[model samples]
Structure formats: structure tokens, C-alpha cells
Target chain A: MLAVGLLGLILLSVIALFHSLLASTSKSNDMTVATAMAQQRLNELVTQQPSYRATYGQDFPTDVLGQAVYAHDSQSTSTFYSQARPELLKDDGPAFGRTYYLEVQVFWNTPDANQVAANRHQQGAQSVKAGRVVYVPGS
Target chain B: MKRGFSLLELCVSLGILSFVLLGIFGVFELGQSSFHFASLRQGLQSEARVAFYALGNDLRHSSFVTVTTVPRTVSVILPRQESRGNQTLDRDGLCTAGVENWESPGAIDIHSGFPNFDSFVVYYGTSEPEGRLIRQVVRPALVGPYPNAEFSLVNSMHDNPLANSSRVGVTRTLSKRLLSFRARRDNDSRLVVVLLRLRGMGGAKPGTGARADETFELTLKTYPENTYPRV
Candidate 1:
């Protein structure tokens, strides 16, 4: 009986470790997806700089530029999304030339939310826990 | 004397230990997941700051004169102001009442005044999902006559959405999820404003709840009008 009990405890610990690994893997995947979305958008914004400058003047307005615009061509349709504000902090020191700022944000659902309720009910008295993913451009 | 416990008793104790171990492991995994999430949140804030700074640099140079006048309220330097004294005469032909309207040159009205003068209206063109696009019309004073008239169309920071050929190497935005974009001339003649939001929740249609959902504030300043002596 003692031998059997010890073996069972060992199995439980192994199972717990396996579960933690799986959760981490899932979170990593979600983060990659969000990052890809953000990077692609950032590249597009940079490319459109010249024309956007001509249309909106040298000084672009956040309220006017940050809003969504649905534009289409013969080949396909694309949405031009812009951040409400720039994505970076400015330096107090003066610099030459005009520079345009671009910022991208990526968000994903938390893995914890899906399992929180189940864990909570099963524990009954114990505190339940969970996890999520969010991505920003700079850091 | 006999063995401390029988095999049967030992087995029962082992089963209890296993149950407790499993519970503990579950809790540990939960903590790991939470940490990953926190990393992502911090990343978002950092990216927003980078974008704001890049744009601000350009706005600081919007003025024509490095030190034309002290920075003040918009009203003080308005292109048109009521005359401070008599409207009768001034050394310069400019109206004695106030500064002459820089845009009064009939033929060159659009291009005169400021160098590379462009309208400041914000526009959301049909483009991509979660995208913010703007178009401005600029008039340059250097007129060469005929085909190359002074007036020209330019894109804001983002490229032009409507392009017939890819020759320009302009890529079309894949989404339209722009939020709020506001700008104003700063005391230094630089364009200063903050963008409140951009990008929708996800695969949301334009104007839908997801599409309009943006929660970031990015302030940027660029394009200072140069100060030029009046005629």
C-alpha cells in the first residue's frame, strides 16, 4: 500500500508540470499571431507616407488620420487603420527635419478565462487562477 | 510486534498524496500563464510611445522662420487680424489694418502664403480594415507653367490608398480601423495634436463596435510653418 501511494503522488506531480507547459505553449502562439498582425500594419503605414502627406498636409491630425477608412480598388479592398496618437515618446531636445510617428498594438484573449470557471467550481474553496496576451510596437 | 502498517493502508495514503500534488500543479501553471499576459500588455504601451515621438519631430520644423516671433496663442498670429491702428497707410502695400491675408494672391492663392501649403482636413478613404489614412492638397509657389501646375496631391504620413499601378511601390492598407486624429498649430507654428485611438478589436467591419474600438492616446507634433517677411 505504501509503494502504491508514493507512485500515485509522483504521477500527479508529473501531470501538473505537463499542464503548465501546455499553457505556456498556447500563450506563446497567441502572442506570435498578434505580433504578426501589428508588424504588417506598421509596414503598410510607413509605405503610405508620401501620399498621406500630400492629402493631409505636412502636419497630420490625429483625429483626422487615426479614424478608420474603407478604400477599395479593382484588384481588392483594404482598410487603412491608424493609431489615435503616435506610438512613441518625443525627446525634449530639438532635432532637424520632420518625422512621422507610427504605432501598432496587438491584443489577444487570456487563456485563463476559459478554464477559470471550471477550476473555481472544482476547487470549491481554493482560489482559482488564469492568463492573457497583449503586444505593443516599441517594447 | 507487527509491521507498522499493512499494504492496504499504505495504498490509501498514496492515493491521498497524489490528489494533493495534482491540485498544487494546476495552481502553478495558472501563475505562468498570467506572467505571459502581463508581458504583452507592457509591449502595447511601449509601441504607442515610439509612434508618437517619430511624428513629433517633423512638426517642430513647420515654421518658416527659426525665430519669427515669440510663440503665443493662435489668435495672435492669425493670418488675418483686425488693424491695431489706422487702416490708411503703411510703408508696405499690405493692408494697414492687420497682416495681409497670405492667401489673397488671386492666381497663386492656393500656393502662395506658406511653402508647400496644404489643407488640414482629415479624411478617411476607402482602404483597409483597422487603418487610418489621410489625403492633403498642397500648393507650391514654384510654378513652371503648363502641365506641372503648382497644385499637387500628397499623402499624409501614410501612402496614398488609391493607386492604379504598383509602379509607385505604394502598398494598400489591408484594413480600416482608424480611431480619433486631432491636430492644432502649436505656439511654435508646429502642428501638435494627439491621436486618441486606432485599430479595431479584431476582424470587425468598419463603423462596427469592434472596428471603432481604440484605446490609445498618441501625441505628435510636426510641420512648422516657416516665417517669411510680408510684402
Candidate 2:
């Protein structure tokens, strides 16, 4: 009876370890793919050279990155924003703006909210986050 | 201690031992698969970094840049090795290749117009899915006639490649398992966005990701500092 109980305990511990290992591997792989997605977005935006007046408030896809059938335990997607800060700008050209500051943020287990809250007290979190930025002329 | 008489103890012990062995073997299989993926990802990551270094170095110093669609090659016009001291670069971009009548060889070697020939570096792959990336430097022929052939040099290198094959100076292969290399010229940013995908030689093993999805991809936009500085 003692031997049986000890074996059962050991088996449970082993199962728990394997579960954690699988979760960790999935997280690592998701993080890597999310990073690559963020990089692709940044380069595409820079190459497009979006004008501030045109794309200032528009999202690239207007939707979340859809989960594939193979994706399990984690979800992934990315979004981009275009803004112009006079203080950050070397020279703020005009009212319409000649320069744009573009940012792309990738999230695995992405946040639920589409827009970031203005209230500081609001809590929104993501387990995995990666981002890239570039400055381009707003044509 | 019932002298090998109890069958219950023997059966129970054998069952536990079998369970332990099964668990160990399962872990071993999982470990093997994990190790394979980790190594594959690491190898591809390192190769991508090396390719980035080569592309970045050439793009940063480019005097002009050209990209082709079909085979997907990037050709950069780089200024020839500047003449040291009083040495003048001849039509072949070598001080010792042969002196042209226009070059005095020791008179400051300054030209009123742009020099006829500049060093060219072309980055191209062999073919799709299993291509090897190649970078070649070409210095044009001595005493060739186009006085202003900045675009013409690359034109000939692309159109009549056989005729200009002899002009190729050095060729270096970057990667062996390149799946695709794409470059898009962003005229607004004056930067080229380059994308490279590398795959492993063998087929993907039993894994979570499919073989087609196992490729490692890298993308970046780079502008020529020499060509667009303060412009």
C-alpha cells in the first residue's frame, strides 16, 4: 500500500512538470512569432510613408490578429499608431504636419480593449508585448 | 518477508516499475522534440543576423541602389576605393590597372565631373526555396565608352550578364537555405525594405508548426547614408 501511494505521488509531480514545460514552450514560441510580426509591421509602415492627416486615426487592419487552428493556449496580434508630437519633433512643419511618428506593438494573449484607456486607474494587461517605432515623412 | 510466497507484492511492484519506465520514456521523447526545435530556431536566427550585417554595410555606403523583380536582387553603386595620396583611380577603379588620358595620376586626381566607373555590389540568390545568397562586386572594364553610365552599369549587369561576367571582382555566398528574398523600394522614405526567409535543409519533423511555417523571417528598412545625407 505504501509503495502504491508513493508511486502515485511521484506520477502526479511528473505530470505537473510536463504541463509546465509545454506551457513554457508555447509561450516562448508565441513571443518569437509576435516579435517577427511587429518587425514586419514597422517596416511596412515606414515603406508606405503614411500621411498623418490620412492615417492619423485609422488602424492598419481594423481587427485583431485572428487565431489559427494550430494556435493553442495563446493568442497573438499587432496594431500600429501614427502620431505627431511637436515637442518630440525636430521641427514641426505645419498644421497638417509633414512628419509622422509611427509605432507598432505586438501582443500575445493580446489585451481585450481596442483603445487604450485615458484613465490612469484603469488596469489593462498583456502577458507578452513587443514593439517597434520609426519616423517617416508624411506625404 | 514471506520468502517469495506472496504473489500480490510481486504484481504490485511490477506495476509501479512499469509505470515509472513509461513516464521516463515519455519525457525522453518530449525532450528530443524540444531540443530539435530549439536548435533549428537558433541556427536560423544566427544566419539572419549575418545576412543583416552584410546587407546593412553595403546599403549604408551606397551611392545609388537598384532592385530587380524576377530573381529579386539588390544592386548598390558604391564609390570605388578612394585614391590614396596622389594615386588616381583608372577606368577599372584600380590605381595600377592603367592610367587614362584624363587622369594625370598625380594632379590631386580631382574630376570636374563624376567618374565614369564606380564599384558595384549585387546581392542575389541562386533560386527559390533552396537558393544560396551571393554578393558580388564588379568594377567596370577599362576604357569602356559610357561617360555617364551610372544606371547603365547595372543595366548591362542585369541584361547582358554573360558579357559582364568577367567584370565581376569577388563573389561571396551568404546563406544556403534561403527560401525567398524580397526588396521593395520605398520612394517616400528613400529606404529599401528587405525581407529574407531562411529554412532548414531537411523536412520538418513531427512538431507543432508545419514545415512551410517553420521558416525564419526577418525584415528591415535601410536608407543609404552616403546618398541621402542631409539632402
Candidate 3:
């Protein structure tokens, strides 16, 4: 009877470890994806500086930054969202020939709270944990 | 006699094990699919970025070539033309499009002394699936005389095609789909604004279908000789 109990415990531990590994990898993938999406939105806005400067008088328009949602989950869409915001501007004070900005502040979401909790519980059965990562664009 | 295990108990245990394995496999497959899509989305996004930058560079340095002062014709000037820029377009050979030269390499001819200038029109319609095709018409500055006869420098992003708009048609295939196209001038009134939109390849929709409408916008800034700061 003791041997059977030991074998059952071992099997449960193996299952828990496997689940932990999968959850951690999924989180890692999500972080990478979110970061890339944020950067792309910022680049598109900044590259069009010349045109915007000519039309809107060199001031970075905050209202122009738009939001997008990405479906990344399975069985249901995993929602990944991002938006662009200006951080700095170098205008000529109305006399310069060109304008530049140190635009920043793009953010995106990771997986959902409930989803992460449930996934963590599944791994915790064998003392495994999910890996969470965050990325700030410049730093 | 030896006792045997009950069929019901055996079946129940087998069913539970199968269920556990199925759940694990299901999650694994889902994770794999998500990863693949994430990579594909990233690739398409990057390609779209490169396309935008390419168009933006050309637009920022756009120069207008003058073909005629009486009936002004303008051509977008490029730093250099590609060798394969020439393209012969024949849709049953009924209609033909070709290049028309300007008065000089970077001259802007005027029509009746007005600001009216010539432009290259690129036509984009549904033809290829999940691919972009562009056709540009190069109109010369003059019609006849020694100054005319289609200038020797045949310019194009693609190769130079037949000059005869009546003979072999002229068409240029762009690197991608032309999304939103627009041009305007700055407060100086001579500086020009050109906005170009290019479609992304390998998108969820490659053609003008339900999901293939992914596009990138590029903006370019330019100035006429009169508006440019003199060196």
C-alpha cells in the first residue's frame, strides 16, 4: 500500500511540472509579442514627422495615437492591446526649420488575471511556478 | 480459481487517464498555435514597416521635373532609377502608357504661367492574390522638336518600357500595394506633402478580401526650387 501511494504521488508531480513549464513559456511569448506591438505603433507615428509638422505646426498631436487589440489566446481570443503617447518635443519655438520629438509611453497588457491565477494553481500542485516578464521600451 | 478485475472499474480508470492526457495535449496544441501566429504577425508587421520607410524616403526628397512651360508636366524625381524599371503592360494591347520627359532633369514646367504641374498616376486594382502590383506613367516635358524626342535618360523604379503609349503599354509594378495616396504643400506654398499607403504581404488577407486590408501609411516632405533655401 505505501509503494502504491508513492507511485501515485510521483505521477502527480510529473504532471504538475509539465504544466508549469508550458505556462511559463506561454508568458514569455506573450511578453515578447506585446513589446513588439508597442514599438511598431511608435515608429509609424514618428517617421511621419515631416508631414505632420507641415500640416499641424510641429506640435505632436496626442489625439492621433490610436488603440489596437490583438487576439492571442486560444479557445477564445487572447486580448493584446496597445496605444501611443508623446513624451517630448523639440520645436524651434516658432522660428526653427524642423521639429523633433522624444515620443514615448507605449504600453500593452499580459494575459488576464484569472487566467494566470488558474494556470499558476495547476502548476503549484508540484511546487512549480509561472515566469512573468515585463519590458520597458528604452530601458 | 483466480478473481478478475471488474469491467466497470477498469473502464472508469481508463477513462480518467484518457481525459487527463487529452487536456494536456489540448493545452500544448493551443500554445504551439499561438506561438506560430505571434511570429507570423511580427513578420508581417516588420515587412510593412520596411515598405513604409522605403516610400517615405522617396517622398521626402521628391523633385518635380518640368517638361513644358506652356502646358506644364511634372515627374517625381528619384536619386537613381533601377535597371529593370522598364515594364511593358499589354491588356490585349488596346491601351498603352509610357514616359513623357520634362524640360530638364529637375525642372517644373508651368502651364499658362499657372502652378499647374504634371504627376505620375499609379493605378492599383485587384489582380494578384495576396500580392501588390503598381503601374506608373512617365509623361515627358515636351511633345516634339530637338529638345523633345523622349529624353535619353529613361527613368523608372522598374526598367524603361517602350516610349510609345500607342505601341507597347507602360506599367510599373510597385514593391507593394499603394494604400492611401495624397500630396499637399507646406505653409511656404511651394513645399509639397505626399502621403502613400502600402499594403502588407502575407497578411491574414492578401487580396482585397475580408481580412487582407492591412495597409501602411508613409508621409514625405518636399520643396520646389523657389521654396528651397539657396546654397
Candidate 4:
């Protein structure tokens, strides 16, 4: 009986280690997706310029570049996030055109919604976000 | 009398030990395979990352850009921000024509009011013998043209890259193992949306049910931060 118990514990530990490895791989994949999606959104806003005012909380295309990429965890009621204020960060130059801040917050989660909710209390606290301030060519 | 276990009891214990050992070995093998798959996936991701960095650096300061979707080619015309040896030039032909208007310390830039000068760069995807590839061509300025003496080497390489692509400057290979390269652009924003997918050569990992052809994809959108409205 003692031998069985000891071997069972060892097996459980190995399984746990295996589980964590899988989690790490999944996290890495999510990170790549998040950064790329964030970059895409920033690109669209800076490039489109005029239409950016309306897409403050929009999600960029995902997967193959024009598809949705995630399911929000249940604690996060909405996948949308507000953009930071334009004047939040200052990088204006006397000669460079008036600059504005651009930000994209990517909210994604595993399909299992409740797994992380018990630990995370804040909305978007578990998400990956990327932001950049764009310089207008000339005023 | 000191007596050890009977032969039958010893055999049963050995059998149990063998089963436990087998289980342990099985777990170890699973771990080894997982590590292999993860490493291959990371390798593919890093290749995509290299392309992303190169594209971002070239696209950010572009004064003009053109994109062709079918072959996934992007052409960018950037202001000559760096000095060539001792000569600095721009649309105003500062060093060439002896002008004094540019305010930046030593560099003459388009923003200082020269709109139509500087060379362009081209990045396109192709299928080569090794694998699908993304390549770049560094074309010289069509308008003001660099000092003739300074660019003769590159000019010759560009004219005949078949014999000179490896010497650098004229052409470059960005990434390989490319499964797909797609770029979408519009006239209004002139933003280029780039979708890149690369496949790994490794076979599928056991017990994972994953396909042998491991693919990684990266998507990006970019625009010339400095391009001007058509006059």
C-alpha cells in the first residue's frame, strides 16, 4: 500500500508538470495574437486618421487578419475597452504636427470562462494591451 | 530462520514495479515530445517576428507607399534621413545645391519642404528552391538620384541582381517557409494590411492529434506616417 501511494503521488506530480507546460504554450500563443491584433488596430487608426474618432472601442481583425480572435472571460462583461485620452501622454514638438495618443487593448481568454474569474477581480486585468502615440506629418 | 519472500510473491512485486516504471517512462516521453513541438512553434514565430521588425522600420517613416496584393509586394519611398559618408541631400538638394533652409542639425528631410526626392524600397514574396520566401529590393532614388559616384556599385547590382543579390544592398531575403503572404490596401488611408503564415517542417507530436504541418500566422497593418495629401 505504501509503494502504491508513493508511486501515485509521483504520477500526479508529473501530470501537474505536464499541465503547466501546456498552459505555458497556450499563453505564448495568446500573447502573439494579442500584440499583433493591437498593432493592427493602431495601424488602422493612424492610417485612417479621420475615422478613428468612432472606433475608440473597436476590435481589430484577428486569426487570418480579418476575423474575431477571442472569447472574453465571464467576469469581463464586455470585450470592448475605452481608449486612453488623447492628451494622456505628451510628445508634442514645436515643429512636428500636433500629435495624439493611440491605444489598442486586446481582451482574450480561453473558452472556459470561469476558470480565471475566481482570481481576477478587475476587468481587462488579465488582457494584453499595446499603445502608441502617432505623429501627424505636419499641421 | 530468516526467510525472504516466496518466488510467486517476488514475481508479483517485480510486475508492479515494471508497470510503475512504464508509466513514468510514458510521461517522460510525452514531455520530450511537447518540448520538441513547442520549440518548433517558437522557431516559426521568431521568423515571422523578423519580418515584422523589418517591415515596421521601413514603413514608419515612408513619404509614399504602394502595395500590390497578388504577389504581396510593398514599395515605400522614405526621405533620406541618414547622411551618405560626407554628403547629405534632400528634395531641396541641400548639400548638392548649397541650400541652407533645413533646420535639423545636419540632415535634409522632406518634412523641411522637399516632397519628391529620395529612393524607394520594395519587399515581395517569392517561391524559391529552399521554400517560399519574402525578398526585398533596395532601389535608388528616381528623382534627385544619389551622387552618381556614390551609387554606381548598387546601380550595377540592381541592374543585374541575378549575379549580385548576395553582395547586399540591392536585394535581400527576409524570411522563408512562407505558406502565404497577403497585403490589403486602400486609397483613403493607404494603410497596408499584411498577413503572413509560415509552416514548420517537423512531424506532429504524438498523442496531441495535431497535424504534421505546423503553421504559424502573423497579421499587421501599417501606413506611411509621413505621406502627404495629393496636391
Candidate 5:
């Protein structure tokens, strides 16, 4: 009976180790996808004309690269940008130019949402952000 | 009569139990190492992504982009705050000269009384072994042509201490464990592509045998929008 108990304990430990490894792998994959999607959005934003971009709203309409955009959550803020240096905007010197600060945040759902929530008091979604400044040449 | 096992039976069982325990331990060690390696690789990739986005944004918005062969540098001329008083002035040469003349100018003419242009440069620093990737920004300063005060300012920023100082616009280490850093302008001279190779530091623990020296290579490209006026 003692031998059987020892064998069972060893098996349980091995199973737990494998489970953790799998979870890590899954999280890594999710992060990669999120980063790529965020980059794509930023690239799109930079390519658009300044007039068109000024009309952008808070949320992006379509899904980004097949991943559903996370709903607004308290854990993180969505994509947005403000004037990095508002004082510079008021300058009427020879260097006066239009610069817009931009940021894009992307998030995706993870497979272990339930398990993570049960173990830790948090959601299972992973998120990444890409931010940069956009410059418009004076006409 | 059979209450206890004979000595021979006891010896055989002991041998089998020891072998089983050893096998289990070996498997556990392997699993641990694999987990560590995976985690390290993920971390490296995450760092690379952050560095790329930070640099790419600046490149895409820069008004001028220069890739100097010597010292292997990527310098970007960020947009400057134009004088509100000269909003109607033709200082950019767009109004005085036609589009053709504006495009043919050998060098950008910096009109006086205009605010200086800020710049950002990325290069490898003096960090030993695998050097660190350094990003240095020079605040608006009186600069002449291509290699002017701004260029010197950027070089000085690189050589200066990493701590925040008034003279230094903004200097920071972009990433560490950089085995190599290279930058070049595309054939059209419109895009700048940066290549970086990073390796993990420190060897795995003696017994864990985990992979501690994994290397990751990342390439990033960006097109500066306003470097050249659209004909």
C-alpha cells in the first residue's frame, strides 16, 4: 500500500509540471500574436493621410488579424494619443510643424481563462501596445 | 511462515525501486530545463518587439533620415516646432522655388530664427562582451549642414554617462545582450532597416543543463514620410 501511494504522488507531480509547461507555451504564442497585431495597426495609422486620421474614434471597427479586440477593461486603456508637447504646438517659429502622438493597444483571449481566473484573481487575456509620434509636413 | 519476505526478494525489490526513482528524477529535471529555456526565449522576443516599435515610430515620422557608414549610426531628424509667426512665410523654399527646385536642393537650408531641429540616433555603445543598444536624442540646437553641431551633440550624448542630465537630451539603453547591431538605408533611400542580434547571458545551472545562451535576431524597417517632398 505504501508503494502504491508513493507511485501516485510521483505521477501527480509529473502531470503538474507538464501542465505548467503547456500553459507557458500557450501564453508565449498569445503574446506573439498580440504584438504582431499591434504593429499592424500602427503601420496602418501612419500610412493614412492626416485629414483622414484626425477623424479616428476610440475603438477600431474591424477585428485585427483574426483576433477579437478586447472590450474596454479596467486593467488597461485602449488605443489613443494626445499632443505630446502641447506647448510646442503653440509655437509660431520657423520649426512649427504638426506632430501627433499615437498609441495602439492589442489584446487576445487565452485558452486557460477559467483556470487562470480560479488560481489568480485576474483575466486570462494578454495585451501589448505600440506607440509612436506622427509628423505632418507643413504645406 | 510467510509473514516476511526472504532476503533475496527484499534485495530485488530495493533495486527496482531505486531505478524507478532515478528515472522519475531525470524526467523532472528535463522538464524544468525546458520550461526555463522557453521562458528566456519569450522574454528576449518581447524585448526585441518593444525596441523595434519605439525606433520605428520615430523613423516613420522623421523629416530627414541619414544612415552614416562610419560609426554605424541611424539618425532621424524629427519634426520641429515651426515658428507660429512665420506660418505664412515661404522659409521651407516651397513658395519661393517651384517643386522642382525644392527637390533638387543639395542640402536642406535651415533658415535663421527658426527653432532648432531635434534628432534621435541609435547605435551600439561601449558595453563589454555583447554591447548594449543605445538610443541618444539631441534636443534642438543650432546646427548647420549634415554633420553639424547636432551630429557632435549626438556623439557626445553617446559617450556621456547614462544618467539623466540637462546637457543630454534623452539617453537610454534600448536593449542589452546585443551581439550585433546594423543599419542601412534602402536603395531608394526612403526606408531604414535595422538589424539586431541578441544572445542570452549566463550559463544554465550546472545540474539543470538548461539552454542559457539562446540567440534571437530581429529585423525592423520603416519609411520616413516627409524626408522628401512629393513631386
Candidate 6:
């Protein structure tokens, strides 16, 4: 009887350790994918040359494991000055420029059904964000 | 009367127990190593992302780019009005007063004889095995003779800034842990490709057999959005 009890205890401990390891590995993999997706989306936005738009639509054509999606938005402002700074005036030209603020968010489905349901209203599951600022010539 | 297990049986049980415990410990060690490797890889990826983001942002807005092979430098001419900050300062570290307020949309009339650009250069420097990616922004003391003059100034700085004390710019360290850095411009597409290789610092202890030399490489291709029209 004692031998049987000891064997059972060892089996339970091994099973618990295996379960924890699997969980950790899965979480790490999810995070890695999320971060990569966020970076990719941010790069796309930077390359597109931000337009003077208040908000951008949430559309990511690439699908990650059929579970991850990405969305982006931008804020832009154009500032114009009546008088050019004298020091900057070489040919005494007028001055103007535009600034763009961009934010990208990537969302992925979580494995836990309960957690997914709880966060469904907040955008399905887990998410990661990347933001950037860009300046462009304006008139 | 029944007696306890014989000596042979006791010896066999002890041998089996030792083997099982050893197997369990081996599995635990393997798991630990894998977790450490994953964490290290994640850190490296995050660092590379930040470095690329900074480099790409500046390169994309540049109006002219000159890539030199010998020192692996990418010099760009960025419109002064489009630069991040409102004020432009000279080598004296003092802001140029009236120039700061200039603002215009679309491309500046470079052909119309307007002084409208700043010089920015990105290069790799510092000690090997642990180098740094540095970005230097040089705001000219005087406007006009620009675009062309700016290019020459940036090239000079890239070759050797220390030789000339009058060089005006702010040096910023973009990232560290660099094992190798290279940049080249594609002749056909006019896109700039930057290669960065980094290695992990590894474990603090000298001989714990921990992973101390993992390396990662990243290749970034960027298109300059505002290159000047070549006549």
C-alpha cells in the first residue's frame, strides 16, 4: 500500500510539471507572434506615407494562424506660420509642415474560452500595440 | 514467520529509484534551458524592432540619400520644415531665430533657390563585438548652397567628424549590442538595405555553462519617400 501511494504521488508531480511547462511554452509562442505582427504592421504604416486623415480603418490582410488581426489609426495636424523665422530665411521663403501620429494594435485569440469571452467586448483576446510619429512636407 | 525483503530485492529497488530520479532531473534541466533561450530570443527581437523603427522613420522622410560603402554610412538630406522639432540650431548650439517658424506643405521649391533641408547621417561605430548604431543630425549654420553643400558636409562628417571641430550636430546612440552593421543602396530600386547583427551579453558568471553567445541578424529595406528629382 505504501509503495502504491508513493508511485501515485510521483505520477501526479510529473503530470503537474508537464502541464506548467506546456502552458509556459504556449504563452511565450503567443507573445512572440504578437510582437512580430505588431512590428510588421507598424512598418507598413511608416512606409505608406501618412496622409492628412484623422482615423484609419482597421484592416490587416495578413492572417496569423487564422487567429490574429491588426488595426491602425493616425492623427495629423498641419501648421502654417505667417512670418518665416529670419534665421531660417535664406531666400526669404514661406514655411509650412505636417506632423503625423500613428498607432497600430494587434489582437490575437487566447486559448482559454472563459478569458476570451470575458475580453470579447474589449477586442476578442490579447493585444499588443506599436506607435510612431512621422513628419512630412506640407503646403 | 514472513521476513522483510532480501538484500538483493532492496538493492534492486534502490537502483531503480536512482535511475527514475535522475531521469526526472534531466527533464527539468532541459525545460529550464529552453525557457532561458526563449526569453533571450524575445529580448533580442524587441531590441532589433526598436532600432529598425528609429532608422526607418528618418530614412523614409529624407529628400536625398548618399550611401558610402567604405565606412557603411547613409547620409540623408531632410527638409528643415519637416524635421521633428520646430527650431533649427546652428553649430553654436543656438537656435536660428526666424528659420524656426517656416512651414509649408508638399515638397519645398529646392529649384526655386530656397534653403530647405537639414543633414542627417546614420553609421555604425564603436568597439567590435559590442558596437553601436549612431545617428547624427547636422543643422547648417547658414542656408543656401544647401542640398549640395549639405551632402558634402555630411560626407565629411561621416568620414571623420573628429578631424573638424566646427561640425554642428547632435549624436544619438540608437542601439547597442551590435556585432556587425552594414548598409547599401540598391542601384535599381533606389531602396536602402541595412543589415544589423547582434549578440546576447550572455550569463554573468564565467563558467556556469549558461548560454552566453546567442546571435541574431536583421535586414531592413527602406524606401526614401522624398528623394529629389535627378536632372
Q: For each candidate, what's the DockQ?
A: 0.02, 0.12, 0.05, 0.22, 0.04, 0.04
Report the lDDT of model 1 for residue B119: 23
Candidate 6 residue lDDT tens string, B68-116: 3334322322122234433221111101111222464322446775545
Per-residue lDDT of candidate 3, residues A69-137 (tens digit): 322231233444333344333333434433333344333343432222122443232111111121122
**Candidate closest to the true structure, highest lDDT:** 4
Better of 2 and 6 by TM-score: 2
Q: How much is A56 displaced in model 5, in angstroms?
A: 35
Measured against the true structure, the TM-scores of the candidates, in listed sequence, are: 0.31, 0.57, 0.38, 0.62, 0.51, 0.46
Per-residue CA lDDT of candidate 4, range B112-221, in tens? 54433333344544433223443434333333322323323223322223543322344555566655566555566676666766656554354664434456666667
On DockQ, the candidate that comes out on top is 4
Model 5: residues with Cα > 4 Å off, grouped in runs:
A1-139, B66-115, B119-121, B125-127, B140-147, B157-166, B187-189, B201-212
**Whole-model Cα lDDT per candidate?**
0.33, 0.46, 0.37, 0.50, 0.47, 0.46
Best by TM-score: 4
What is the docking quality class of candidate 6?
Answer: incorrect
Tens digits of lDDT, candidate 1, B37-64: 3333234334443434433333333332
Worst 10 residues of 2 chain B by lDDT: B89-98
Of all true interface contacts, what fraction is found in model 2?
A: 0.08
Among incorrect, acceptable, medium and high, the docking class of model 2 is incorrect
True contacts kept of each: 0.00, 0.08, 0.00, 0.34, 0.04, 0.01
Report the lDDT tens digits of candidate 2 across residue range B1-231. 556647998898789788778866765555555555555555666677687677766665553233322333333221221222222211110011112334544322345433334345666555322456666666655433223243233343332234454466666667775656666556666665667766553233333433323456555566555443333
Evaluate model 4: give its lDDT.
0.50
Question: In terms of docking quality, how is candidate 3 classified?
Answer: incorrect
Q: What is the alpha-carbon interface RMSD for each candidate?
A: 14.8, 6.2, 9.2, 6.5, 11.1, 11.5
Q: Give the Cα-based TM-score of candidate 6 against the true structure.
A: 0.46
The alpha-carbon deviation from the true structure for residue A33 of candidate 4, after best TM-score superposition, in angstroms, is 1.9
Poorest stretch of ten by lDDT in candidate 2 chain A: A68-77
